[model samples]
Target: MGLITEARTEKLMQNFSAIDFRMSIEDFSVRVLNTLTGVIPEFNKGRVMIKSEDKIYRCAAWKGFSDDIRNFQISEDEDPISADDTPKIYRNIYNIYRKALHGSMEDIMIKSGLPEVKVSVVVGIFFEGKIVGKVFLESAMDIDISKYDLYLLKFVSKVSSLFIGMKFFQERERRYHKDIIMAMVKALEARDTYTVGHSERVALYSVHIAKELGLDIKDVDKIYWGSIVHDIGKLSIPEHILMKPSKLSPVEYELVKNHPVAGEAMIKDFPWLDRIRPIVRNHHERWDGKGYPDGLKGEQIPFEVRIVTIADAFDAMTSDRVYRKSYSLEHALSEIIRLSGKQFDPEIAKVAVDVLNRVFPVIRNS
Candidate 1:
């Protein structure tokens, strides 16, 4: 009997077509390829390739070809469909193309050390009237597959295409969110180019400190993101105050100090981002209870917030300002150690310096 009976194909199709938003594109592709090689006994190897707008074929998944199948991109490759099948396949945008490959599918069998056969069972995936991808399966037992078996392979191809389409939509949504965030960042930088890259540097510095202190993955991620947008509240301050080249008066300094509270308020509606709110609000707080806003001190300040506090200070000291030159690396590091338990948390301050030495060894210049 040929592999992939009608009943089995129906069951597989139902499961594969089910949309899963939790799965990332890479994870979804891997899951599809793994399931293919598992149930279809005759298919000793399998792969899915999709076309991009640039007229090139990109590998989305490949089992028995490489450990990481997402690496390769093939160019100058022809469609796996035959001239006779093209008319039929293109007749319906949802329909798939099937054929026996004597040439094209050899790319995998050759690399995977399978026998170079005259042809392998191949299925071309079609999504919305485009030849977006194709999946190839090589037989292991040298059994001749029945016509129905090929039909089942075509059905599986459609399931793979469904997952890929979902992946594309998910990515588009994320890019939209990212574009909005970046626009805000750009607006802030426009007012004060001196701090153009300050947020990103603080993020990198905090990530290093998180690693040095052995914080778990979740805490590390929150700290990194919070550091990147720590100064977001500064956007609420007047542009003239932010752009001031001279020392701020007491009234101007008070307004500048309200940024941490404003930053927290901006993201208060997002529960998923709650972990970061503390980090942002308390980023300016001191270890001695002398800081503004809430005056959180010692361990009372969120651990991640303390990490960012030290990182923010370091970047500010090392970075150039319109009113003054940056401090030397030696002077900045010395000042941090001297101010431990005064301006910054003593424990986090030590770890911050160690992280600096480990991550950036070039100490000749700040």
Candidate 2:
């Protein structure tokens, strides 16, 4: 059957133009496959798989995979297969992931003695001319792929490689920043023994709340970055007040409140962090207009910032401090509930309580 109709070609071009640059690798993989399968009749069902470090991630799939195929997962250590080995499978083995992945996916159906085609058409996704991934079109009968089809796939794969490679580098940069942020948080927290793991715990709590509130990925990510750095401004505070074993003097208290402003200033120049600044700066702001920095009240706080505030307060109440033992979960929840509309956004606080109880099963059981 002639697969690439003239109209199909135009539509494929249109679909190719729809690829989103800012998505995560897995998301991009799924979107790419969806677009391809949506427009191309020959590409009835296929998927993209990438081997990263220790795992083979079946990042995306469109129809045609059985339950076994849909459930396939493989570890790099088990097969000792390299990206260099992949083409050989397509070229010679025909079912490498099936063998390597323990009969998890396509190979299972193939091995079940299901009737199949002798040939598969695939395009290698390359970065700097080495295959990092692949695009595939599955068929039940041998495919007499045309020159136009090959060229279209090659063009699509080439364009997609740039996007995938961009996502790869973008993820690498995010990891680098994660390490730097964690180190900075560690150093800042090290100044007070009681504050160890504070940022991480707050981040965890904040993420749970963000998810429970049904926030989008970008907003959730912003919450994570903001929560982890909420105390980054404390790096500028003098250790004497930060490590004070007793209640702070009025002057010391005022200085401590300055950390949010200082932290906001420290990160304002980081373009990647521009979206995260509001959460870091206004996390201390109150719902009823009684909070810090600008004392902006109620819905005036960014919704993202409001979420972090509740998470921050919950963690702060639960974690041990130099001057006081951690509050019991029950007590902390009560205190938070009491202050919901006043100290935290009532809606966010309510959802945060549910997330803590449900997501942390220990809290639920206790």
C-alpha lDDT of all candidate models, in order: 0.69, 0.72
lDDT of prediction 2: 0.72
Q: How many residue pairs clash in each candidate?
A: 0, 3
TM-score of 1: 0.67
Tell me the tens digit of each residue's lDDT in model 2 across 104-209. 4555556422234344456667666665676665555554666666666666677768887887778889999999888889999999887887787788888888
Off by over 4 Å in 1: 1-7, 10-14, 49-60, 66-71, 76-134, 139-143, 203-228, 245-247, 268-279, 285-311, 328-366
Highest-scoring model, lDDT = 2
TM-score per candidate, in order? 0.67, 0.84
Across 1-366, the per-residue lDDT of candidate 1 in tens digits comes to 324466567556665766586665556666666666655666666556667778666666666655443544444344434321111222211112113333454455345443433235666666665666666665444556656556666666666667667666766775675566567777887889788878877888898899889997768978877887778889999988888998999999998999989988887876656778888788898999899789877888888888899988998888788787888777888889999989898988988887776554342233
Worst 10 residues of 1 by lDDT: 85-94
Clashing pairs in 2: 69-105, 287-298, 289-297
